[model samples]
Target chain A: MQSPTRAKKKTKATSMDIAHRAGVSQATVSRVLRGSPLVNAETRRRVEEAVKELNYKVDRHASSLRTQRSGTLALLLFEDPTPDDSHINPFFLSMLGSITRACARHGHDLLVSFQQLSDDWHADYEDSMKADGLILLGYGDYLAYESKLAHLVAQGTHFVRWGPVLQGQPGISIGCDNAEGGALAGRHLVAQGRKKVAFLGDASTHFPEFFARYCGCDAALREVGLRMNPALQVDADSTEQAGYEAAQVLIARGLPFDAIFAASDLIALGAMHALKEAGLRIPEDVAVVGFDGTPMARFSNPPLSTVVQDTSKAGELLVDTLLQLVRDQPAQSITMAPTLQVRASSGG
Target chain B: MQSPTRAKKKTKATSMDIAHRAGVSQATVSRVLRGSPLVNAETRRRVEEAVKELNYKVDRHASSLRTQRSGTLALLLFEDPTPDDSHINPFFLSMLGSITRACARHGHDLLVSFQQLSDDWHADYEDSMKADGLILLGYGDYLAYESKLAHLVAQGTHFVRWGPVLQGQPGISIGCDNAEGGALAGRHLVAQGRKKVAFLGDASTHFPEFFARYCGCDAALREVGLRMNPALQVDADSTEQAGYEAAQVLIARGLPFDAIFAASDLIALGAMHALKEAGLRIPEDVAVVGFDGTPMARFSNPPLSTVVQDTSKAGELLVDTLLQLVRDQPAQSITMAPTLQVRASSGG
Candidate 1:
């Protein structure tokens, strides 16, 4: 095996070297290198073979130097309130796959890391010129992180974040219409003849996404001339344990709720387990709905019903918007539409 | 929000500038920068405040030039043979979290990307000198990718992969003892009085990890003087759908198997669904076991029993080994022991 470090010391082959080896003109070599259709397949193959033989590399650094851009983007994932050490939210993992594909499609390299909220986090990427811009995902508490976002803005950092797309939020943001998603779940449960629907997730400013979802659900219930019972709202994070404890709390309250709408699938799955342990049959007794249609939702005991965010579109838009900011172009916040995925848990 | 691009042009403050502002000597500044721990808490706090105030950067590029090393590691994830567009294996995702943390602990930046099997994939990092070394994960078919690994080896690329720790493989690898994991599962099944055990996974050389697992299970069965029924093994990939189909195949063959050991949690989950659909009570008519002990296993109905690889240890070893190779030190392959997480599905 050849040592790559030793091979790198050898001078890089130029297009002229390929042209000499392939017995083609330099212009033809350039045309082939540019992937111009003007070059025929036979000639292109010959040029490619010569290029491979010479171990040539296009000097991306030179191009980057000219543009003053690293041609890289950083993805900062904030720790989620998970039950285990992984800390990553399963929903973010799905979104990560889409974002990676989108970056590759747009000719950008991605640098992924956990969001370190310390003062030096920005210096780790942007200040070091490792990436041109940043894409933030999974802010634990929106209110707690709001000041940091403002600090980033004050420093003139080019960033886009995934969160509730509310007015006056810092920087460019891309997110699903959480309110619409909540309303969709509420309507579905109401249509199933579930009158007393309980909510499991913090519906406060600290968790803006859950709050928006709660408002939407509230509006949906009110639209049908029914008011949400405050006693049925239980605060919980997006974790199975949190959901389980919240359900226990709701059960302890002795509220006669017939349906439960968890802000996330992890929460809903935990709630289902708790309800089952309490001798309640899903859908037949207490219908359930969840947000973030993760793969686990499909395999849940009753196959959870959820509001599906368009991750592919979300990823594409996030990358595109960040690139726009990197290039000094105007980028706007975006809120994507949500679709309901009805499964056995909701009696769909 | 401040524009990061605009902030880039501002002359960055130096350690001397920080020292002057903090009313400390340049030597004291250097000591604080190196984290000598000799400095008093009050002095450290003052220096840190000054450093933050001036927005100072450590000029990583200057240090990198002195050492011919990029101070970065690349993690290449090969697309798994999954049922959906998100080709990432859940097991690898868990590994990713550990690897990321390990990199941070070692003061190295991580560059993450999906492994594109095309020829230019190596050029994406090693040839370009973007990263000092590579940590590879998830090779779908070892045989198909063997030549590529050889090419990387010939090029003197510093890389370590997660796979079966066997002789004659092209490069260094870190993996769990698949054979031991298989034997552990077999012994547990035997203890449960399950004599007829079905294996659902491709146990051939093409998938070395799974093949090792089968060999271990075979050895354990032989030790107990119980031969494995060749007709009971059904080939399937590590996916829920594939597991479901393989189980159906096993059932159709009229094999009186009381136990099923799947190659992955996904497969076991799928098999359990099929068994429930066919009205077979878990542990009464059939018991199931799986590998990769992912989060989904805990949540699966009846809960899946699985072989849990120490991903945290594996990640640390993989990073440590590759760094050894990067520093021109002798690095050896490592095999970690697996633990059996006996859950409800196996009647544990």
Candidate 2:
């Protein structure tokens, strides 16, 4: 009843057939059958159904020898030049929280560290079997890290970063829509009858994320017959001190601006302090808006109105996407939508 | 030229003599020379001096062959029943920052995870060679953790906790002086003529840290011919919602309170909102004080006056103490002093 060739090639063809029927790669089916954490819930279900539908024989011994897994993920935080000893920027705290919870849910142990001092970490972490993959978080000059990312790709390291999702980037990235967030801030301020809006952040390709925000705000303003004055745009990193200094510079330029749109909440807070020191009443004299609705925004001096990113969702997707890559599955860059939260600072 | 018996026992006795001269155990000398991160600066200095003074021949081969070390520490956070999805209590954010920096200083990688999900972590972490030691952080019922800690000691797993430093505890602990912190808050409020001071926290033996704070505040009030009225105190955990509800409950009693000292900054923030809703003016109708000098306290509506724990120092000490235990060296419970930061809420 069975053909000789079909019987001889039964195991190999059945596995391939199972992969085809499950709409997954053979590697994913192997991962699912071996109980790999890298396989997502949906993929596992599809693989299992395909096995049953094909009447595939179970090979427990072979599945047990699939590969060694540490069931661990490492989070390498590229240090922020924080104003305080808390190595984390307050903005990353919420992201860290979501990542921690996500790791727990996926049953993967998370190893956290600053990427500053560790040398050859690209080889030391995953290649040494310390973790199954790496989750990178930080804000730095994109140009400086470009070569390092290329090296990581050359080494075939499984890593995912929380940054701007750009084409031809070395690794998969899960990011909040920074450009849309900037536009949202701009649209909100324009609706409040503010004509001139000054931006606080480095608007250069060296920092792609900030550059996108700058362009997005500029585009939004142009729609209302207004464009952001590059002369009014002061370069500032994501720190209250930097923000304060940038505002002082903007004020000294003698530029008449009706409103300020900071790229970050910390920058907005610093600018607010400078404006208040200059005796400007918020919303009455200078309407202000900030991005990144961090918890601190709720308690800011005037309660900052800002663009909010769903960090929890970003974190969950980051973990899932990294796992997918670890399991040799196809994964794509993800850009999440940002919502506007209007508070006292925006004259709301 | 050496006596036959002395020559025969030379290597062993000389090592012991080095240990005796260094005023450290033989194990510590070995650890120091092997470049163990477990040894502190002072201890390593002593051992190095002893080696030079004794003219001990450096055994390169044996030193290189010292026991396997992971150069890693695991941080297990005992979860707080937080009001939000940010798994961490904001108080720990500074601590985490300090700990991360501290780990970097010692050249050790840190693995951070919630202790709630993983069962048999005591065996899973150190026993399975995941880490050399563990640094535990959380604010939970001490009664429930007491037995588990005892088991950790039984299994000879090295660990240090961030909690109240008590005598005869299962393991070493590094903690802030809670009693002193509470007294500092009470003293500041009393200086403002706040007589009827209300306390917000579960001040019971189950929560020894809060209980100590409660007693300390009560003692400070007694110094001014006043004591904490049991009716004025409300039981609340370390959450803003709990603080808000506790404040509502306190206000519902219709008892007049001139001051409120919350156990945590989050609780204080919550209570302040409730007080404002009841049309009470802060630092006028009621002076408010909180514990944990978290950054959020800076942006509170009236800027909360808080008792500041030296989280940077605490984190450093926690790592140092855990390393001491990992090296099989004698370690003690450390209690760091707390300082008060008076803000607008305290009528400063």
Candidate 3:
């Protein structure tokens, strides 16, 4: 058998060739190639078989020029505060899967890369016609990253970000209702008869997602005729070690806190470790709740109660929104609803 | 600030233009653009500045035609037995991070996609010149996937996979010393006075990695004058749920086991969950050990004891091997040494 690599050196196969082999009209072959629903299943199968036999590839560059569309999207993952060199947060990795599937569904290839905030990274992918638009995920310190978003905006780079849907933000964003997620955790803890709830995450304007979650938790406290104690709030980056240290700090302060609301599951896992080490029984002494229903939450010592961000919806919306921007359509920011998953740690 | 997207409509700046602006020869600019290390830091910086100023791209298609290189590598992740729709194993995800970094270091853009086993998936990417070569990870049931590997080899696809290094394997592969890792776990468990050991995972030729691990465990047992009881072996796929079910099946068989060795960390976690649910204490009633030292292992209820595959080295090796193939260099299979990370579950 001739090596396919060597075989490719010959004249490339075209859709017309596939159509001739499949005994179908060129138009039918085109419909199958475009993944048009108008094509019958048997015909599509025949065309696909013909394509496989001939090893035909649609010339992406030629098609891109003709349609003024690259048929590719770039997923730029900004470096996050990770405990290790991986830099990717587990939550974003989950989102990556969804986004990849969503892109596949929409017949687009994805170009993934790590984005450093310091570099002139924004001037490459889309500007070079490598990708039609960009989907941004996990920007550490939104306040610092906001200027870069404005820079992208001024450059007319079609893009969408997965973050807190703040009014007047520089670009279209698709995010979970972080405030509602926080409120869910807060309400659950409060109903469990926990008076003092500690928030363990960077809760400031600089970190809009965490800040929104904090606000929601605060609102829940207010609803119960209680208020979040300023001293109970410990600012920590989204990491297990940071969460562990934050929990230790909270413990050191001699504050009477019976519950904790971590902005992320990683933080909650670390806090749980610290609480266990400190000889505090979960739920009996302190109830804990976390956000982002990562897989780790399901397998934690006592399953973690967390706010489940609908990653499937988020992925579809991100791709849809970015595609709209690529088409010069007016795109708007969308906030997805969050669901609270009550597990053993939350005394459910 | 003109939108970069809009500005892209103008003729792209050329290397000659950058050379003129930087007061260097076009060859020097080309060397800098190609990421040749021969260029001095000052000269490279000057050329980079000129590039930024003129918004220059090396015209990938033109360069590709001249060099027969796309300057891109495709990282194809095969679907694994995942508990959720994500279909990604955490261990491979870590490798993905390392591979991405390696590609960037080599001045190659990485195009990542999930591969389904049953498809003409191999006909695209490198065949279309979208990527220069491929780095494959995760193939569930190697026996079934072996034909595909052979097909890839027959087609002369320049690719490398992460799997067990065995004789007659179709292509160059980079894998961990699974047998050695299993022996390490076995020796540790034996030292802790465990006699009857249960092995969770398919221990057969169909799954070479797990089979190798089981073989090593058998060797360790032989050294201790104890033979592995065939009845104690339970077949399980890579997922946690599979592990959980495997553990349950082992328990139901009424086997007298003092230790359990899982093929992967996910399986170990699931087995641990099952054992705990059955009211058994880890490292007391039964010592449990797993392979693949993922981040989750560090935070598992009783930090999991397992074998740590050097993902960094694996990534570097896989990319280097694939590049060697792309350059028509003879590539050899490599097996990285695995280190045993003895944690709480192993009574370390």
Candidate 4:
């Protein structure tokens, strides 16, 4: 093998080199080399010709690997054993875009795997020899997968997980400032004189996300001189339909809530739709706020006022943190603060 | 080398063998083997012990190659160089989610590579002996990466792309019916008594997606006893801000238009915001219909009426198509039809 210094010197084709030959924005040149579709065809052709003529070979992957990366990150999503994949929320889509972009910026690629709770495909898994790190998403009794993940950690694989890390498992976990977000919602509703505010969450479990959000709401209610209304707290599956059904059930029980705070944007949208069908004017008859600054929030009817966590930043930071850990660098569990984006539904 | 059959049948506890030993999904076994975080710790332990006891010697580099597979698919995204991974349209996200789901269901992983119009990251690409197939999404200009892709095809790599098959490109192209989506948008706006409708699309000189959408809208208008008033055709750079500005320009020109058909959900959402801020009521004031059944469409203020394409099917079809091509089977282009999802935005 060549000396490390010699290899590094020989492989240097800096961004400046490509820019000089391509005669475009260094950013444009980077985009060209990154194979982004943002540029024009004419520009791409010129850049390619320049690259071929200059013989500029950029070992993005090797460098990433040397920096303790296999130059790849894995996104492990829990697969539900069902035929219909329609129930999937768009949050994954948004998160994926951010994660993919972050990987590209660092000159790394993303590898994704899905874990379905089935038996026939096990024969296909003996080939697990790629990737330097991982970012785990998805849910549904992933205890078995978490155990294997723990083993990988024991074997020194660099990884970071969002949501809950397996009980006391060693890994970096990043999540939204759920407590703050919940408090923001609670305060906003109370400020609008909504004494009878209701809390709706997607899951019944005491996952950190749900618990934090719930706690924040409780704290906010306490601060605002209100009592925690247990009867107003409802558990709904995090879906638009579920939100609608939950709201319907509450209405049927003769609940008189002036405002509703749902944990997710999808659930909020569904609640809004149900409220509309029942001839209720948004913010006039009842106000609503949702968490998850999903793109859907911006476009929701009356637009949803919700907590917008910086997903792109989160994705970028997650990858960066994992990369640093891979390089034997110290890392911390990162939590991003959620911003309250006030919209029509939230009395903006 | 030993006879191919002998090599394949050599005694090694394959994933299937281990899966048979432990009653679980094949995908789960692959997940555990890959150290996915979606499995339970107990199941992972069982699989790990099985591997150790059975002496499963999995050759990382050779497994995918030996089976003529990387057990992974490549996702080629055409992206613009944006600070925050430019506002990804719902269509792309929907397609990506479906693709990811399909790869998961079929016991395969996904390798995502973003190819911009002006740059080429062929360094890592050259070494990515991984990935048995490629799924091209949001690739605007085929010429940028088509040749390299062609070279790979000639070298007997199996891949499938979305959208039109490039002239002389050897691969499968599975795409949503752009023409149909355009027609549906046009028809919806027209049916709502909106006469002077304008078409907003992304920049088309570089990539063909916008152009295809434009052609489809034109065809629909022509069928409905109308023609694009040339002056009403607007092109923005495919950002919310751009869409907002385009609507302003159109409004400033006082183009005789009572409707607007934006090519993407993002563009449509921007246009809606711009129109609303300018005191235009949705549907009642100027009906709007967007293409791409993004989740945002369902949540948009007044709920956007748009065209929904089956992205999951597209992903699955791409994989199946590539596998067939790898087997030297004849595969044809698949065009998926878009269904019109009526919502409040279209005044439905």
Give one clash count per candidate, in the order shown.
13, 0, 2, 43
For residues A124-159, write the lDDT of model 2, one tens digit per residue. 576445577899888888887777777677667788
Q: What local lDDT score does residue A70 receive in model 2, on the 0 to 100 scale?
A: 62
Native-to-model Cα distance after best TM-score fit, residue B309 in candidate 2, in Å: 0.9
Q: Best lDDT goes to which candidate?
A: 3
Give the candidate number with the greatest DockQ: 3
Q: Return whichever of 3 and 4 wins on lDDT.
A: 3
Pick out the ten consecutive residues of candidate 3 chain B with the lowest summed lDDT: B1-10
Using Cα atoms with residue i matched to residue i, what is each candidate's TM-score against the true structure?
A: 0.87, 0.81, 0.88, 0.78
Q: Report how far off residue B21 is in candidate 3 (Å).
A: 9.6
Which consecutive 10 residues in model 1 chain B have the weakest lDDT in total? B1-10
DockQ of each model vs. true complex: 0.31, 0.14, 0.32, 0.21
lDDT of 4 by residue, B141-206 (tens): 555656755554544445567875334445557777777787787777777877787878753645
Model 4 chain B worst lDDT window (10 residues): B1-10
Off by over 4 Å in 1: A1-51, A58-67, A80-83, B1-52, B58-66, B80-83
Q: Write the per-residue lDDT of candidate 2 for residues B114-198, one digit (tens) a residue.
A: 7662355654566435577888888888887788887777666678889988766787788988999989988888899999999
List pairs with backbone clashes in candidate 3: A4-B155, A155-B3
**lDDT for each residue of candidate 1 in A169-265, tens digit (9 for 90 to 100):** 7777899999999999989888898889899999899899999888898888888987677789999988888899999999989869999999999
lDDT of each: 0.82, 0.80, 0.84, 0.69
Per-residue C-alpha lDDT of model 3 across residues A1-348, encoded as one tens digit per residue: 111233233456777899999999988987888889998899999999999888888755545545656778999887753336653578888788888878988988888887676667877887667788999988488878989888777777788999988877787788999989889988998899889999999988999899999999999989989978879999988888889999999999998999999999999999998999999999789899999998788867778899999887788999998898887766688889999999989898
